[model samples]
Target: MPGEDMAGGAADTGPEEWADARLRGGADAQAAQDPPETVRHTGPPAPGMVINARYELVAPVGHGGMGEVWKAYDTKLRRFVALKGLLDRNAMTGASQAEAMARARREAQAIAKIEHPNVVTVHDQVETDSQVWIVMKLLDARSLAEVLRSEETLTVPRAARIGLQILQGLRAVHAADVVHRDVKPHNVVVGEDGQAILVDFGIATFDGALAVTQAGAVIGTPEYLAPELFDSSAHGPRTATPASDLWALGVTLYEMTEGRTPFPGPNAWEVQVTIDTSPVPPFQYAGPLAPVIEGLLTRDPRQRLNAPEAEAMLQRLLDPRAAIAPTPSAPPPEPDPVPVRRRAPRGRRAGALALGAVLLAGAGWFALPLPGDDPDEKDGKRAGSGGSGTRERWKDTHPLLKIGVKDDQPGLSKFDPKTRTYAGYDIDLAYEIAERMGYARDEVDFTTVATDYRSTALKVKLVDLVIASYSITEERKTAPPTGYSVDFAGPYFEASRGFLVREKSSRYDIEDTSDLQTLQVEVCTARDSTYEKWLPEAGFKLVESPPNTYQDCLDKLLDRSSDIYAVATDDVILAGYVKENPGKVRQLENVGGAEGYGVGMRPKSPLLKSEVCASLKDIMSGQVWEDLYRKNLSPLTDRKNPPGLPDLTECEVQSAGP
Candidate 1:
């Protein structure tokens, strides 16, 4: 087994002897590549002289596409280490070989110079008669890809955090002008401490060495390659851009979230075409992972969110009410407790620039009022504080906190008679937050928008949070950098944009959406916005029209104004308008697959937001969360009840409380 572990100990035989035996025994294809003597050296190196006796190879740890990795002991320092070797045949070729060696040397230099927790530190690089090797810190855990295969699946937030950590490492590499062109699951090794250590920069190249690659030799795994790889440029399949790594990361995320790649095929070629030509499947069928997939799979590179953007989304998904604002470690207080200043007005560009800088510097706390009733009571009130005091007082009462959800209905905030207030799932979540913060349910203002306005509303500061079952992903989070924040909760309900046709309509015979032809599509404004980017890529003609709520779409179907109603199933289920409506509506059997719903918030609202997250966590800790489901959402519960945990203690609530 090529991947099997080679345990600790000294073999009585030398490298050449073992290699000859293995070759004669016909060991694996990998063994066939190594000369018998090289194969003998494959196992942990027996005591050996290296670089005039400064270092020694102790054991072989692992092997990959390029070479074998060894666990070595540094004789001078009395410490353990990892040594990587490049023994691939092409490394000994002509000019291409020299270019490869130069690239390898650059990667070694880059890894050695950089210092980051997530990045594996390369200690030294050395070349032997038959190999090029890099000495690095020995990692104790398996590759992340292996860990995932063993563990099967991880919670969305958990996986996202791991991904963000990996991105952070990649960011450092990119900062050094190194693109980890081979970013993939196997390259990320999970250490014993549960941190992700980015490893194997074997094919990584500095920006200066991008031209080293030969045509037709893809530097990355086909499944993870970016669509731009198909571009007939000198730069291999996918051009080696920092963004290309991000795209691979997106594919990694999609696979982890959904338990399968967004584009799957029997072989790599089919997958490559799908990557370059197909739209990512909707995440609605992904259950709890829906929001995570959407965020990571955004197609546009500029729009592809990276570490900082991903960190925000992960933190939110993990703890929704986490302060949306970036919380850098606070600095020491200003001398003599000078009164805090106000954000400069936008009229003076310098003032706005300074204000923005101050906020980013974590001095925004000085601009926001502390948890106090009035500013006049502070000792510095007399020090030209009136102007700042008035604004701070007003802001305390009217914190720019708000949530905008996507709704196409004429009156989205209709009161629910069953719950005795505005009580859709989205409303309930938002209402609970507002109620705890001393606002009547109705005090939380409602603003309706088409799907496209979702990002715009957040960017313009028209909304502080969006709880309208929005799908969260890495791509969307980066759309308006520092504008929107997504923290996912219970995916609560499943939703997707699928075709619904009249039972008697001529197109009713159309089974899957792919089967429909020359058809008029009736879509709610919200559904249209989501599908506009996805459906056309899937090859469908989208008939643009005025926005309609799910109920309106159903009505239009009965009236025969449109041929098919494409809408989210949740809206369809909630509207109850599709119930036995003269056989006018039936969801396509294999149409839109799975997608999920999540809460979205502005990037800056941390105060009440963290509190809201605490409340949700609190609810999820006990039967209250499950009861919300057992009462209202029976269809979603697992067939076998998940084993219950210890009951929530008062301290748990207090500790978890925002």
Candidate 2:
């Protein structure tokens, strides 16, 4: 209802209105503290004042946790525009100011490129009397938040219509590879002309970009948050897919129809609890529209109804279709329960051993996980909840800790099928972790995992941990957190992504090809790299290939099939291959990307994450981390200025809250 809040709350900087508080517990409570009529009015540009010489502010429209929304007139265009500016811009300094500026820039960048009939349009971002302002499309219509606030609830057909329109905007947003992280009712504007527009790209996440969030929490409204978001269990990287946004859409529909939040609670944390553990309550008023709501609200992201699917269902409601499922003659057979199997790894290189640099603390050195245990919960309560749980029984049942590593990665993990042995930086670190667990090198089991399949292995309990060069991203962390059931630890190493080309091929070199928009070169990269998704959008003629492994991409370049290979992955990986191939391949020093290597684990292993995080921090800060780098990666990397590892603080479990 207030102006699109990309900058954080008054207390902190980030998209505050719904960004930080919805993820942690801020906005609503913070707003309640301040009276509704409160206007920051800290400095210049009072009502009717002109800003940036062109826009004349008619009046202050609304004020909330984020900033202030102003109704203004664009003098040049002779049309109205919403001049959104920060309330406390003139009064802030230090980190807060820097954070606000970053959020503002991010919002402008995110929305400026998008053009959809159902999305709010951004005209320009300008500096007005020392305060930054974003000029956006003005809508005289009431927000969906206001609509509900005025008339408690809407009929099923009306709710369905609004949802369908929202889905149309979402289709365009996701098509542009953006995840509208915040999708609450307040952000949706419904015009009097019957047009519904999805507004606020302030917290939307694009590929390779991290959403600025409250330091220890997810960044979205907890009530509308998908169950996958409440996943502290899988302490790994979080990713929010299209289904996540759809889940919020489902929540919005429910709220519109029922006049209340589907998962209602006084606090964000309590809302998360209900979403994670509770089943969907029957919507008495839903009638024929019940199926759409239930399908979209499914807990498991994998099984949840997607945007297109929900769109079709809502479309059917808007324009009734003849399609209907006939009643089954008999009850369907129950799906076989998936068994959690923990076993001693198969196909071991017998007698292969590693030495733990030190002895473990004691029998309790390993993590003891309490399933569904909230990080904020007391230890005593967790201890008494589950008797001899899986974490507790890990040692007794499975003697060795099963760790998954990549089969072909050079510097990270390289498995030798002939010798049945594993080597490289990841292997060494796994041994280091195992030693800390009071086990011999052979006591830990090693399993081969493909890059894309690692999440599955961890989810199914096929592996206890993954030490591959996995880049810990916001998307990976939140992508169906509860459903995937995995955790992450230690960014023990930091690498940069760069381009590799033949030494003589000046045309494919980074220096030779500056402008991507006008460039004429073919680019090939590994299938799993994020660059594969965003590169074409940036104007690169990508070479598609079957089985896009790092080796495959390299082979394509060597075979003269592709002019260049662009992988936003480990620089050391490219370095190793380049060195081995001599003058044939060279890395483009200018093309660089950040790639932090973190270890992956399964859900319900917060203690494991905590323990691994400590080890990773030690490996990152202490001499052991350096020694491993020198021994395994230094020969191929830039030894003089080796890349520094990322801060493991982000991976640390926040027992308190975001």
Pick the TM-score winner.
1
Candidate 1: lDDT over CA atoms? Answer: 0.52
Alpha-carbon runs more than 4 Å astray in model 2: 1-45, 86-92, 95-99, 206-210, 234-241, 320-658
lDDT of 1 by residue, 1-658 (tens): 1331222222223354423343355555344333223222323245443432444565567676666777665544545567777546544566556666666666567767777777787787877544567777766667767766765555444465566667777777877878877777777766554577677776676755535456666556767766555454423445676767877777777665445667776555787678667878744112323333454555544334444445444444444433233322221121222232322334664443444345423522112222223232332233224555542222254543456653322122233334333334455556665665556644565444334345544543345566664654555645444234343433433554556565666544455555564453444433324444565566665546433244555566667655544543343243333343435556664354544554565443433344555555565565655544443333322223432332322112222111
**TM-score on alpha carbons, each prediction:** 0.46, 0.45
- Candidate 2: what lDDT? 0.62
Q: What lDDT is reached at residue 312 by model 1?
A: 44
1-658 per-residue lDDT for model 2 (tens digits): 3445221123122332322332354565454233223233336566546666667665565554445666665656655577776434544576567666665666566666777767787798876433567788777567788778877767555677677778788878887778887788888877665567787664577755545555567767778888777674542245676778988988998887666778988767898778767888745445445566777787766556656446545544444321212212222222123221121123421211111101111212222222232232243234235655634323343465778777567766776755667788889998887776656876786766555546655653445788877777766777644345345675677777666666665454445334333564667766545666656776666665323366667776676555454443457778877876888877766454577777887655554565566666666667777777777787777594446666775566533111
Worst 10 residues of 1 by lDDT: 649-658
TM-score of 1: 0.46
Give the worst 10-residue stretch by lDDT in candidate 2. 352-361
